[model samples]
Target: MAADITVIIPARNAAATIGAALASLVPDRSLIREILVIDDGSSDRTVAVAVECAQRHGLPMEAVSVRLDSAGAARNVGIERASGASIFFLDADDQVMPGSLSLLRAALERQSGAGLAIGASIRRTKDRPDKLKTPDGYSPDKRQNTRRYLRNELWPIAMGSALVAKWAAAHIRFPEAIHLDEDTCYWTALLARADAVTIEAPVLVYHHDEERMARRFITAPRGTFLAIARELDRLATAGVERDALQWRKAWIAQRIARQLIKHRMFADAAGMMRAVRAHKELGGSPKALQYRARIHIGRLTGIGAGASPTTHPAMPQRTLIICHDPPFPPTSGADLRNFGNAVAAAAFGPVCLASVAPWNGDAQPVDHDIHVTALTTDSQRQAASLGWRRIKGEARIPRPALTRLKTLVRDFRPDTIVVEGVALFKLLGPSRPLVRQLILDMHNVESDLADQLPRKSIWRPRFSGVRDLERRAAAICDRIWVCSTSDRERLRTLLSKPVPIDVVPNGIPRAEGIPTVLPQPAVSDGFPVILLVGHLGYEPNIDAAERLARTILPRIRARLPAAKLVLAGRSPKPPVRALAGLDGVGLVDSPDDVRPLLASAHLCVIPLAMGGGTRIKILEAMAWGIPVIASPLAVEGLDLTADEEVLLADSDEGLADMAVGLCSDRARMMRLRARAHDVVWGRFGPRAIRDAVRRGLGRNDAGS
Candidate 1:
């Protein structure tokens, strides 16, 4: 017997695509007991199109016109009129796949405890092929644990791809107050009491109109944020763990703040944060505290309503250093440069470091008299999706980071603003009067780095967009600082107008003392260790680690049976973490200090395939008098002689051979290490870096 299923499609101004949506359902008419279209105050002929399609198909369908402000209200009305045992929500602009209704109903009938059956949806655009966007933590074979499911899957399960039992539908109502994320709130409430079954098949085709959706979000009124906060509060009150819901709440608030910041709606953004703070569920977490700090800072800095920027007449000169990430721990080359340069800039004036820190990172204390201010928000996570917009030279800033930056700029009122990396150059807008001089520190020619990446990488296409950003930065900045002469020349070619380009090569900190732990050969039974050190969370590092473990390490072990690989770094990603369990490989995460690992190593290996900046790891190894073997790309832009200072290899065989030979030849290893140490100290040392930074900042007196 066919199970009863009702299709409820709530639409507003969906006249253009209603016919195709209805036509796709004709084949499964027997399974669909009723097709109801609730039109919510459409100015177009949407109701007419819906009714015409229903009549032409000769289906048991009806169209109802209602006056409602939101689609959730329309959905609620449809639920009241639905007579089928199972309810399937569809969108008027989308189409259901053939036989999807029957497939969904059969799954429901098979499981007595399951109240909802979800199928995957494929997003389609006019130019691109269909892509499957499955719900987070969705598994076809495993039954979902409700609490775990809700906690893992923060994104909305496509409403058009779900079939809910009438019993479950009776208990849950659509949240009409929220204009955004309403579907997420409604589905979470419905799924709380019901077990869910996921079908691993595409049951619906969702039309992705990026331009229209972006416009809708941009134009949404401030009430939308309030409605979302209220819905989250309701969910928390219904016994869902507030901790499980906190990240989602923070994510929503941060998104709203970003949009507000984009339009320079500082006052509105502050008010929104105040309202968000009032929510019981969202108020007390670390994220909430950060938001409160941002609000307070905004009010104090005259970024909020009726506030004025305070002038510091007594201060002679102030410098603001803006970076994408906090320059502490100095794990990567970029971090070292940023930290070192900021410290150097402090010599000329009082330096304030305004940086973006991770959402979960603990607050770091200030050192070297450089005032530290961190913007902790989850906006960086959203960069993978909408980040391309910024690369395209769009005048946009991620709000969570931007708000703190604006407040700092106004409060600090720096005479000189040193913007680190091209990634954050967009923060320097045309309207700011507080900034007397702007200097752009180019970490690398980012667009050129993009071109060097593999063709399949997501960043490859986006790399072209960065060229425009660099060109704009060059046009506006008073001075441009490149890490190497090669990068400076590249930027000159990329820019239409010549900008003053200064070369400030990356430098190594002066050695305090050599490690007391002498480099020792392993016991007779133990293996000779080869150490690779980096921030394992970085993509290039991850790629290098994987290749070393999977491809290069095996070949090395084959030649020298007792060869061991040690990957020492902080915050290893899942893939990098998995390499730890491999035979003869050690994964050391977030080492208190890397010196111990470097001290015990037989040799330091840098097998990077693609990168733009010079490897600070190589320099560090050389400084420690540890012989280094690195890829040519890893040593790019450095003045080191390949054979004398470093053994360069681009292949697994060459790297393996170099390791085997160097580990056996003690005198040769010591000689190469001595030469490498001389290269680092002579050229890429403290004196060279101090002089370069002083020149770049146009300062004559840099303290020795």
Candidate 2:
């Protein structure tokens, strides 16, 4: 019998379960040639257990002892002494599934080339051991497979599932320095020189009862990350995908930075982060920029909170805004409002913004013409900790981002500094005397928002400290800009200070700038479509969306069967996302460009139970010549007359009936659309808001 397979296991101190691994080979013994257990400094009775198990199962086994302390080095020894033509790498804590060996062997024999045969196997997670998860991105095409692997879209190719020909295996070696993901390096090397076929059958199971990679990383965090960086560099050199590799490097930097932080390896972590900024040239990469920004944030907090005193050589006067989140590529309601203000501020000069960013791609906010400085992702995380906020009595911007902002402040040399949102005004407290005016832009009355939310809401405002933060800002500002006179009145009462509040009513642009109309949609399946647009994650928006889908949409659809309600927005919460599954309800989620949806929509509906800010969505619909139907609260800030500029209703039944009436009455719809368009065009347009911003800056002249 020609049993030509050799199983090489590099193990240390694994005695209890090595017998199961040996027994798993017994059924396929006719195919197995020999087994090599390279004991890499094992203190337990591992060698004896392996020998006894192999002998008991009638399989030839070799026990080789080495004090190398590295699994890669022991694996190298296994390669050196292997007698069989085909070599399979297994771990002491893992085993081949029942039919996986025969399947892999057959797959190799059937393939055109003598190379690597990979089985679809699993690395069993600790919490769910019995449930096997098949590895993803297993295309028969090797090039696509490798690309997917580099991008991390493909799950890890476990070592136990790989069976490489001995001759091809001789060409490459496992990277001894990399303790984690060493097989990835070795397998990628093999994949380059030799052809590989991925078998569909299940092959191996890697159990997590043994020490996991995350726990092992606590010991050599820096070393592990550094090693990964080196391998990434090599992959980049080999002409793998540029963007994917860059993202991988930046993600690795973030991982290593956290690890170092956990182990209190500050100096090394800082050094590593700096090295990435200097040499990696990842300025355009959003993920990398996030890591670097987090590094900057560290310059103001915990250990690295001090910096060498330096100021910029005086730059030309510009308006700078310190906001909470990025304003570019305008995705959410905050982004839309911030973009409008930034545009208005830019009439002075190119405005600069300092905003928060996060580590994951989810929080990636891009820079537009207004040069934006990124804040650490932790700014929101730390700032939003309700318990921490209660204990500290106030939330402060992360020190590193604040320090970076100070540098930007020096360099930008703003005569007018507009601090957007109350959450971020803490950084601009009287450091440099060069600034002429400091304007506070109030987006909403936080106390009003707090009052509007249900008691059970986790975000329900417990802002005893937040009240103080606002009052403190009101006490020391040149002027305050509120979106509506209602918010102005609320602030006047809450702060009880004569801080000259200006009603800068939030604006939407005229249709001349953006493509006003997309080509009409071909299908009328969702005819007389009623649209609701906003950031779906916000509590008020979530409540409104759920209410419409669950209660109001059904009523409207019952009257006009083809009247479909469309909820379109960014970052939808679960309740809002769930609305899409309901009959007669459509959801357009996180669209890259929402203009098409807006242009094609027939009617805009806003039945909000809770809200504070002026609805930008209402203005957008009016601009597109679509009639609006909203609850009184939804239309609170806008200058619209009921049944004239827009239709208004307070109850769900009333709102649904109003929507049905508007869908059937084209003439009335046209009149409301025209009048509403006039309101937005006259009072809430770019030109009008610019004039208001100019007045707020105390400039009656045309130029800055």
Candidate 3:
């Protein structure tokens, strides 16, 4: 018999992999009508490789290149040109099993008038076992089958795993708008109209990569979720039994709701729960009943699942702020930024801080106006932060806090949510957020910082997930805030979509009763104190402190034996404390104030090997009118200039030399102190933060 199946492979920059995909189809050449390799504007040798491989294998292949930029769009073009009665969709990077396509073709041909044939496929993921994925055989009941496809992962309606009739392909095209999961939507829609038969024959060798946009579950915007829901809604109205369609929609809502609830994103979850409840078919569902009971108990307990929270006159707009550390009496650099940003948000309207506080919990009495919800105890937080729970790139929350958070969201529906950093992002859940405005504050372009860190072989894969975390957070957020233009530029490429990125430089509050000109340190007459200030528990600080004590301090002592090095900050780790045991290094552990250390220290040396963001400790030193010598990376985003406001050095020997040089030169010390203070007071102070917050909130307000 002449070939009757047209295989379509939509490729984009797949030069290295497309040949294997083409070669896999050679055995079924007698059954294939033609092969169309649609190259979607490849800047590589995708077309050339496809053509070369096709000729070598003696397979009928046509190479077509166009600037579609979307795989769905490229597939649609291939569909338009296909001549076969049955259409097989293949990805450029994946391979088809030799006999599976033959089995699939026979299944459709055997089942009289069947429009689709489904086969098993094995998904190959990195460092994981190959698992067989086969669809549950189709039944006469369309609604039941549809529901099963939506609910069960094993019953997948995957593109390469299923072969559909040419008519069905023409009737239902792939959604071109979304960057990911276009195939899922396309298959679901086609499966709705076509009666499919299944065989447990493996067809596709799907290679899965977590970084692939199509496989990523967490980072999509609200528009992407809406697009999926809207299509399902349309399918519900379009002859595929409404019950089946509605059930899938409701199930999707519940899935999203569970994620939202898990993260204590209550308002968003409430909205999703309402959608789930709308599926009248799900009225008696255990999940549905559970959602109903929560809302019922919430209302009785005065936490009403009210409509969107804006009817109250007191709050024109509500905001929710998230932070993993304490937000009161800001001690560390992170603490100061989180607290400052929260205070700024509180000024415009009501603000609620969701503190994922430490195991011991926050000690400060947060008695002020803004409501604080302590979500976890030390045990719960530790349990939630475990490696197993975070493999999927989302932070887990305990069951006990879900309702409390839902109650808060139901009662206090925030119009905007300010996620402090990527540290707590996983706790925000896995799908599109329901809040009107979502803002991400980047203290460090954390993914960039992570890339710079030296990792042990065993820890490499786990730490690599940080990029996914940050990228996914960026994908969901409406806008992003960075500390510097350099950070803004580096971070833009990491986002799944282009969001408005604003550079909100880090700043410190102007201290009271401080003289504009600081007096020269008593270094010439006494021991010279060279300080390195930071949250000593932090990895970068720990490394820098250890290096200074073990290496740099000894070099400095060789020139000037009286010079002493002090590591000052909150929460000094064991390694940092060990620095004090060294000859000239002193450890200031968990100081209530660093002002005394700054006041006495003649020169601050930050000889960091790897760090991120503008060093806030450097700013604190400058604000106290102290001279600083830091690595170039430490001085990033700050207005301080090397050889003028601050001294910059990349090497430990050079840092020690600068410290020794400054000890005797009181005139140079005076000049650096005065200049550095002016830079901080004039460029980096409380006013900078206030202005940035107002601008950020104001833009959202205008848009709303």
Candidate 4:
């Protein structure tokens, strides 16, 4: 119990919070004789604050200000300066919680068996001290007992705010650069050489300020993986056993995957794909490998089909691109911009995208990269107004017209013809045996949508026939692709096909991978900017906008007194247009760009109460590193947690409260942003997705 405990705090400008952090050390003042504050080139009164705080608290604290560029360097400076039997790293923005020092000291006393003692931190609200926000629990203390931790919330072993033996601390120092998750590198380094112990008690209260919190949560995960790769390189330098080191890397990769999934960062599909690849490099187990694969499959199925067409770079692969609309100019969510991109990405040699839409007189410019062909037939033009569709009477192209497609089929000579819906399959003549592959990209189950309509005779029969054709098409196709597993399983039960069904999810084009750093928005321009991004042409999006304007925005404006709603996306129809002139609603119609607007806004809102399929807007917002508040249905396919990355609600009042909660609590907003980015980079990055695509394409690619 009489072991030395060195408290290492890497402080930047801590004039505001250092006193309280130092004051919290009263319990173990005698035992914790060495408290080192590594001040990394502070421009503020941090050194003076630390000195005054130490004297006020009646404790011995040393402040060393090194002119270094990053916090990681500051941590290393503390490690070198400390001479205690144990070491504990704390952040400048956070305060040491009650009983943390004593508990950490006691745990480190038994360091002969364990290298470090890890503790969890609960995030505190910036405005309201009464509200304890964002509590993260650590892995269970029982060593090698991974069962209980898996069943409950378990934080991974990271260096910041965690206690470690001085000897272990000396051996494993923080990387000198990288403002990001430099801690992960240290964690991996420690885990490789030494075993860890996790304490369940709260030890730190991470103050979720705008600047630090946003960078830490959203941008850090990307760099964390980059650092992990660097750590692997370091292991190589240190001459550690390749096999053992790889296992450690795999363990880290697994934890990262779990964290990403837990937060439901739908955009992180790519990162998950990379994790699977990294795990394989580390000699991963079969179970470990499947973790990301299953997630990839889940995300793929969530988007239904015909969101983005993706293909591996190699192999003599053939692809079919299908879309609900003409996809030219790609204005809508399921448009040709994404369709053409996917087709090009998926096809190794030649690709053809077939679409169905209302024929307008305007000439549509087609992309030269991928072959674009439209088959706009009369079946769609037979306006079946609101549930008037009859099963047998459901319009299909006449037999004579079906024969005409033979010429188009003969000319194109496509190996696979990807159809967006069953109607296209019905239009293609059955006599043509030349087409080797028939791929169906079922964007949504027709019956599922029809079932949502008011239960009526016209609706049921029409839906029933559509369902039958859906099943019939499945039997003939070589492979069926859906957006979510929900659709796949639902269709599997309907289809007679023995053919394989897979998911090729919709994906956001990798956004340059650049962090857009902007000054925090104005606090009092009489409007706390509330942003909603999505095409208003969609029923669900329009419904969400209506609800927010009518119900939620008023409540938020009343509470905050300066709240404003920013409606952005393509095509605002008459009803959506009316909300713009309303008191708090500010509409930006069909902006060629929405990213810069999203960055400037205070909060992104997704109050969707209706519709299905994954909302890529949520994913897109997350990828851009913005915090979002969405309904449970809006985040249906995503792995999101309540009060974490998103705030889920049903009622108008509930949604209004969430807006107020996010507005009042900047720390919570920052925490949500961090969690959002972690979900995105961890689950949906391009690298991860590319790997997943390779796997889905029969594991034939070299990357796989």
What TM-score goes with each of the models? 0.51, 0.52, 0.51, 0.50
Q: Candidate 3 at residue 607, lDDT?
A: 76
What's the candidate order when arranged by decreasing TM-score? 2, 3, 1, 4
lDDT of 1 at 169: 68
lDDT of 2 by residue, 136-202 (tens): 5555565665666765676677878878888788846776656666776677667655677777777
Deviation of model 1 at 124, angstroms: 83
Model 4 Cα lDDT, one tens digit per residue, 278-314: 6455326675556656677767775422221123222
Residue-level lDDT tens digits of model 1 in 176-263 = 7556778877777766667777788888998887534433333332444545767777877556666546655655666665545443
Q: Name the weakest run of 10 consecutive residues (lDDT summed) in model 1.
A: 306-315
Report the poorest 10 consecutive residues by lDDT, candidate 2. Answer: 307-316
Runs off by more than 4 Å, candidate 4: 1-314, 336-344, 358-369, 376-413, 428-432, 454-465, 496-498, 509-527, 688-699, 702-704
Instruction: Give lDDT tens digits, candidate 3, residues 1-704.
Output: 56999999999779999999999888889999899998775657999998899899999999876544468878888888899998999998899888777889889889886788888889889879998887765686656566666555336665688788787666678866455547656766666677778887788889877433221222221333455566666666545566666676677667655544443345545666777777777756898778666655554564533334333222234567777665666677776777666655554445777766643444532322255566566656545342345543244555434445555665667677777777666545531354667788878876677667788533235446687788877777788888888898888777777888887776663233233334455344446788887888777778888888898889888888887888878778788887788887778777877677777877778877776522877777787777888888888777567899989888888888888888778788888888887677656654456457756654333211
The models' CA-based lDDT, in order, is 0.70, 0.69, 0.69, 0.60
Question: What range of 10 consecutive residues in model 4 has the weakest lDDT sum?
Answer: 306-315
What's the distance in Å from true for residue 644, model 2?
Answer: 0.8
Q: Clashes in model 2: which pairs?
A: 297-400, 297-401, 300-399, 300-400
